[model samples]
Target: MAKDDLVSIDGKVSSLSGGGVYYITLENGVDISAKLCGKMKKFKIKVVVGDRVTVGMSPYDPTHGLILHRHKF
Candidate 1:
């Protein structure tokens, strides 16, 4: 699917796991696994528990997504 076809959602980092995977809790209370995007990895962005982040995922699969951006506030 094209980038535009992906849905972006706001969530908070709930836990860290091996292989750079993270569990994020969405606004509706569901948790999904995500991985840092290349831009964030290249910039060395760190995401810890309780940090708000923006996730991009396909509408068909909400269980996994890419960590697109980190919220400053």
Candidate 2:
């Protein structure tokens, strides 16, 4: 399946900081800090506050979603 077609999720970017970490507010009202993997960092992609993005969960913690896709408002 295409990446976009995966079981993606949506959340609002709460904050973006140096070193590539971002705080995102999830639809369920929880917040999580996520960063792109080392490979994704090379692309210089940035996720900003209030922007909607897609994410996946870490295997250890499926409840927490990690930013995997982003769409501009």
Candidate 3:
């Protein structure tokens, strides 16, 4: 997947998965797996699945990419 094609969870952080994986449960209840970006990790911001986040990655592999940022709104 290309970095430009990635996306941020418009919804909120829902759950956490092993191996740095997170379950971002969108408003529609469709859960998506996302990992924390390098910057986020450096900042020490805990990312939950229900927490809204911005992601950057390739469309082919949304799972593999950078999480630019996340927010409650």
Candidate 4:
């Protein structure tokens, strides 16, 4: 897919599910299911509930996405 086909959204992790999946609530109030990207796993990046993250969602399906980046602070 082309780079422009993906949409990046900022959200806070709301919960953790089985198999390393996370449920995040976007700033606009949309809830989406996300999974950590390959690089995150390779780097051993930990994602916890309440952590802020950037999710890369497909414009065609906003209900699911991939957690791209974690905001540290």
Candidate 5:
């Protein structure tokens, strides 16, 4: 789906899995798996466990998403 069609939400990285997969816990207490998007990969942005991040996903699939942005605070 297109980027504009994605639903964005804020979450915290809970764990890192093999194969570049990250598990994030959303603000509402839901966990979802996500991966880095193209720009993030190209720029080599690092996301470790406990970092807050923004995830973008299709409304139809809430269990998976793209790690769009990392929040620094």
Candidate 6:
């Protein structure tokens, strides 16, 4: 999909679910279900609860997204 088609949001991981899924709470107070993207898995990046991350969401389905990047600081 084109980058323009996805909306990026900054959020903190709230919890983990079955099958390596994560629940993220967005800055604007929305909670979305997220999963690590392919690149993160390929690079062996680890994501845990309470971590800040960037998620790419689709407007049509704002309740779920792909965790595209993690913020370490």
Worst 10 residues of 3 by lDDT: 1-10
TM-score winner between candidates 3 and 4: 4
Model 3, span 1-73: residue lDDT tens? 4445555445456677689977665555665666787778888987754556765556566444456777655
| lDDT value, candidate 3, whole model | 0.63
Give a tens-digit lDDT track for model 5, residues 1-73.
8999999999999999999999999999999999999999999999999999999989998899999999999
lDDT of 1 at 35: 96
Model 6, 1-73: lDDT tens digits are 7756889999999999999899999999988899998889999999988999999999888998999999988
The local lDDT score (0 to 100) that residue 68 gets in candidate 6 is 92
After superposition, which runs of candidate 3 have C-alpha atoms over 4 Å from their true positions? Answer: 5-9, 27-29, 62-65
lDDT of 3 at 59: 58
Q: How many pairs of residues in model 3 come into backbone collision?
A: 15
TM-scores for all candidates? 0.92, 0.66, 0.63, 0.93, 0.97, 0.93
RMSD (Å) of each candidate, 1 decimal: 1.0, 4.0, 2.9, 1.3, 0.5, 1.1
Q: Comparing 2 and 4 by TM-score, which wins? A: 4
Candidates by lDDT, descending order: 5, 6, 1, 4, 2, 3
- After superposition, the stretches of candidate 2 with alpha carbons farther than 4 Å from their true spots are 1-7, 37-42, 62-65
> What is the per-residue lDDT of model 4 for residues 16-40, given as tens digits with 9 covering 90 to 100?
9999989999999989899998889
The Cα local distance difference test for each model comes to 0.92, 0.68, 0.63, 0.92, 0.96, 0.93
- Whole-model alpha-carbon lDDT for candidate 1: 0.92
lDDT of 3 at 34: 67
Clashes of each: 0, 1, 15, 0, 0, 0
Q: Itemize residue pairs with steric clashes in candidate 1.
A: none
